[model samples]
Target: MTTTPALETVGITKSYGSHSVLRGVDLAVPAGSVVALLGSNGAGKTTLVRILSTLLRADGGTASVNGHDVATQPGAVRESISLTGQFAAVDEVLTGRENLVLVAQLRHLEDPGGTADGLLARFGLSDAGSRRVATYSGGMRRRLDIAMSLIGDPPVLFLDEPTTGLDPQSRIEVWRTVRELAGRGTTVLLTTQYLDEAEQLADRIAILHEGRILTDGTLAELKQLLPPSRVEYVEKQPTLEDVFLALVGHDTTAT
Candidate 1:
């Protein structure tokens, strides 16, 4: 039996005047799995995400989330999904716990305080729950933003360049959170420009280029597209990211 996709788009098109952002893009993401929409800047990844999130209308074609048509049933589509954008959306004036409480209350969940506390613990922000968000590190702020988005427990999640501008350790923190979310059966549609990020997180990867999907497949499948390679011995070196992570250590307590 085939499982229905949690998110899908077919012949999806978007344009601004003479400039086209998405040109007949087609893609599908399986339920409870992460699918990375990898692309360079201006590759229409954010446009597709906005359309699916009901934040923007598509010029043509169709898209859906959790089986609800994005065009015809936008309310239902929004109800089933959560969107986290490039920057953290937390209120700097509010404490971490207060931010979570605000979202829970906005979502009209019962026991909003309890919900906030639970989310704080889940996101490993419990120790800093009373601290103002202004004092939090980039990683902490991003984690709090994500925790707020989870208040409604939306089945589908759209993370649009979630780690953009974050430090290496912070990026890794967000990555760990994404992995945990996927483990709990959340369907994630992650848009990213980072090849390593996609390779690390996505169960399947789709490369969007020139407003179209250039390729969509597992990492190994994508590698097979290149010509057969001859073996060559190469010296191993720690990458900048590796050096940074090692020097900074993995402790979040300093934040």
Candidate 2:
């Protein structure tokens, strides 16, 4: 039998008093696919995530996680999905292993300790398993936080700016992990401000601006929305950076 979409939002709208945050936003994420929500700040990315995860209610329309409605069936939706926000939520007082164990226990796993240890190893935190989260580096804590999110092995994962504060190496590491998760059939809805990140990881992309989706399509399709890729010949070898600067007419290094 065919499975339902891992996530779906139809005509979702949200507002803050007189200020509208989302206006009839619609989205659908197929099972085992990675969908990147691309937007600048105040574009309603976080608000969308919150509503989908059942933390906030939409003013209109509806959303579902694995066929469970976010409004009337929030508990079922919560059981089928996991969310990791921009900031790591690991407890400073708990050890890396302890945090994972806590999550497993909350999920009512039969063997929380074993599951936690396995996750610690998977995220390369085996050596730091016993170390207090307070002493772990930013990357390590973020890894642990993500590990905790996977304790239940939920089918749908929502990652919102997960690499925001990480160093380059750590960001790459997280990217690899995300790719691996999607490869293993986890439906991922990722929100990121980094255009390059979306280009690299998204199977499909949706651009959000001013609380509405400006466009949604594959990377190649989105590229087609812009001008055609131009070819410039030069005697010297021009780097991708140079090409980007020539095409976009802005110094990428300055940002």
Candidate 3:
């Protein structure tokens, strides 16, 4: 049997007056997989995501999340997905655990406290669960923000440049978290400008340019679009990240 896409959009169009933000965009994401919407700033990545998440209505075209139409069944669409924006949205005044508990309670889930505790441990935030969010590092705050998004266990996740301003180490931390989430079978639609991030996480990468999808394929497939480079051998050198991690005594391979 064929499986329907976990998320999909067809001819999705949006604009601000005459300045179009998205033009006839078509994309599909398979269940329990990660698809990166790769684009630079002003490429309409966020606009597409907002439309998919039902946060903004498209000027034209149809979109769906977990089988629910974004336009006709917006409530169901919203119920089936979670959105994490460019920056952490955690309440600085609340403790990490408190933030999770608040979302669980708002969702009317059973045993909110238990749910909070479980998520804290799941996100590796148990030790800091009692600390106010204001005290957490950028990575920790981002992690907690993501944990809160999981309260309802939405099957489709929309991450809009999740690691935008994070330092290298913190970016790696978020990368590890995304990998873990995908491993647990969540369908993720990640929008990012970082080519390395897409290479590291996406099963398939879709390049959006000038309000349209310019290309879509696996990394290997995309690379084929360019002529092969002449073979050469040189002494291997560590990247700056490698040197920095070494100086800091951090295990580059560690999650």
Candidate 4:
């Protein structure tokens, strides 16, 4: 018998009025693997995520998380999954510690304070936990937002553009966190525009274009689809990111 994937979708489609957002897309993510969904801004990445996470309904097709149908078994799907949206959703007026404590209490986890403290420390925000989130740097707030999602230890996670405003160092910190989570058998589906981030974290990568998947495969498998490189006569040049940053003047002095 074939095992159900940790996350699976067959011919998933969505539309906003007359504007089609997803056009019969299909994907399957295996247990304990990180799959990156990549697309340009309006390629239906967020729309697909919303449907799978049960925040929105698919206009067509079927999706399941941990063997539960997202359309008919939303509660079961929710019990097994967590989503960190593009924006930081923490309460600006609350302290970092308070935000975590609130989620812990709502989840009815015992010893909320200890749990909050542990998470704060894990995210390297222990010293700043008492400060109101209004005073946090963008990276700090982003870290706290992710920590809040980990409170219940959900087996599946959907991170939608999770590191958008973070600094380079904080981005690496979150990458390590994701690697550890997958190592512990948690499945992760990440939607991102950052090519290198996907290269670093994803065991498999899927690209969405015009509401359908362009390709979905392991990095090596995907690379094989490209035209083989011609023999190089000169040393390889610097990457476009290096040239862009140098030309645009990346501010090391600012966070």
- Model 3 stretches astray by more than 4 angstroms: 1-3, 251-255
lDDT, each prediction = 0.92, 0.87, 0.90, 0.88
Q: Top model by TM-score, which number? A: 1
Residues 219-243, model 4: lDDT tens digits: 9999999899787689889987567
Could you tell me every candidate's TM-score relative to the true structure? Answer: 0.97, 0.89, 0.95, 0.88
lDDT of 2 at 221: 93
Q: Candidate 1: which stretches are off by over 4 Å?
A: 252-254
Clashing pairs in 1: none
In model 2, the runs with Cα more than 4 Å from the true position are: 1-4, 234-255
RMSD of each: 1.4, 5.9, 2.1, 3.7
How many backbone collisions does model 4 have?
A: 0
TM-score of model number 3: 0.95
- Ranking of all predicted structures according to lDDT, beginning with the best and ending with the worst: 1, 3, 4, 2
